[model samples]
Target: MSKRTTLQIATYGIVCLAILLVPSFMDDAFILNKYARYLVLGILALALSLSWGYAGILNLGQAASFGLGSYCMAMALKLRTVPVHTGKTGLPDFMVWNNVETLPWFWEPFYSLTFAIFAGVAVPVAFAMLLGSFIFRGRVTGVYVAIITLAALVVVNLLIIDQQRYSGGFNGITDLAQLELFGLTFDAYSSSSYYLIAISLTVCLFFALAVTKSKAGLILQAIRDHEERVRYFGYDVARFKTFAFAVSAGIAGVAGMLYTIVMEFASPTFLDVQLSLSVVIWCAVGGRQSLLGAALGAIIVTGMQGALSESEIFLESWTLIMGFVFVMIVLFLPKGLAGAIESLVDRIIPEDHAVQVKSRAAASRRGVENEAGSP
Candidate 1:
């Protein structure tokens, strides 16, 4: 491998090992859980960065996909805890509280862990495909796509809140029991769970990197920069966009599944527009073009919130501070924090002496006429 590639691989290996091993050494479950949650959020942010940054598709409904996956997992766990009924059964607790007399048929499949996993991924990708087909084929662009996605979040949230019969309204599905992989029990509070999440995050990062570096990745970037040119080149732009959107939604779904497994709850608030926007902010702050940047942004933002919320002063106005910081980054460090770091590194690392000598020679030649006037 080239030196850069080898260096990158080495760096990644060291980082993964550190992330995995460090938590095992920590005695505090709370601290581990907090970081684990941050990592989960980072996974979603990384997915967003890949889809929106690399593909030039802004998905404002990412949280909807995430929420769907989470709720599916929670529902599956809830079903496993309840007794199976041959006929009609009462609704899930929140649904019963909402005055529903019967459980919805659609919810029955969730009783099986396998089926729940299927629905968790399938539902989000299906939604994304349907939504993408309509939007991309219709040639939606700029803020229109954003508006449509925001509307989707609002509509989905409202539907969940109103269904009351099927979906646990307002409250959403919660108290979701811990997951089990085959015969082994998965405890969210243990250091092992933290290791699992860390491993999962690493795997997801690899997958995203692979996808972003593949042939399809190049085509997606082309579509982003010049949709019309790609269309004229005999590619179906809409179809590609739809495919990309589906893949993005699927990744978000996985993150949501992990979120529920870790958080042990699902709520309508999880699909809020603000959550969606916050992800975009994470991408923007971390350098949208870099998946690592997106993850870093999520970690930093979550960490900042935790730190600021605990502070006595400016606790209530943390959002304002975050907003100001975002604006400054956008205006001055357009490439985000990751980009800034790269820029700084490049500046600090001096060029070869030969290159420096050539640069000075070229400069002197350009100013040759001024030499006679220098006296």
Candidate 2:
């Protein structure tokens, strides 16, 4: 491998090691739990990077899938806690208050933890496939895709808020039961929960990295750069785009479930437009072109937000300060922190070597295209 690739791998290894060592350094369960939420947000950033960075599909409503997953897990956990808090009806407190006579058929399936887990991921993937088929097959692109997604997210958010009888409504589902598996409970404030979030983030990071390095990933990038060219090359550009969209949704769904586990509840804010837009900013600030960079961007930005929000001096103006930081990054460091770091590394190392590497990669791509064009 080239020196650049080696350096990237080393950087990723260091990040993984740092994440694993966090719990060892921080003894406070509260701090660990807070950081766990940041890590879960990182996973969402990774999902956006996969779709926006690799596939060129800018989804403004990424929170829809996330909210779906959160509610699915929360439903199961809520059912687990319902009996303790409610009467013989076994309905969620909100439902009981709303005079729901019977457990909704839609919610009955979530009574099983196993089914809930499956639905948490599968529902988002299915939704993405359905949405993607329509959007991509219709040849939607650029800002139009963003608009459609943002609209969809708003619709879903409103629907959830309106269906207070079935859903938790604006209050959302609260007082969730801790996840139990293999006779061990995962408390939101416990080390086990932190480890769960950390491990899931690690697995997702590597899995996404592998996908970006695969042949399909290369084609997806090509489609992003030149959709017509890829189509002319006998590739189903829409299919590839849809597949990436579905995968992104699936990853976001996993992050949602993890979010529910760490937060101990599912809230309508999970599907908010503000949160979705913030996700896009996170990807932009982290270097969306790189999965690892995007994840780190989310974690770092979120950490800064928390620190600022908690500080008495910045408590009221943190949002303004964050907005300034984002503007500065966009004005000067358009490629983001990761891109800046890569540039600095290139300057410190040798540009000649990097140029040669890029040249060879270009030549290889040409050769592949030529082969495809031939009989």
> Which candidate leads the pack in lDDT?
2
**Residues 148-175, candidate 2, lDDT per residue (tens digit)?**
9999999999999999999989999998
Model 2 off-target regions past 4 Å?
84-89, 351-375
Taking all chains together, each candidate's TM-score versus the true structure is 0.87, 0.92
Would you list the clashing residue pairs of candidate 1? Answer: none
TM-score of 1: 0.87
Q: Could you give candidate 1's per-residue lDDT for residues 2-92 as a string of tens digits?
A: 4444655666567667778867579698888888888888888988888788888898888999888888888988765543332233345
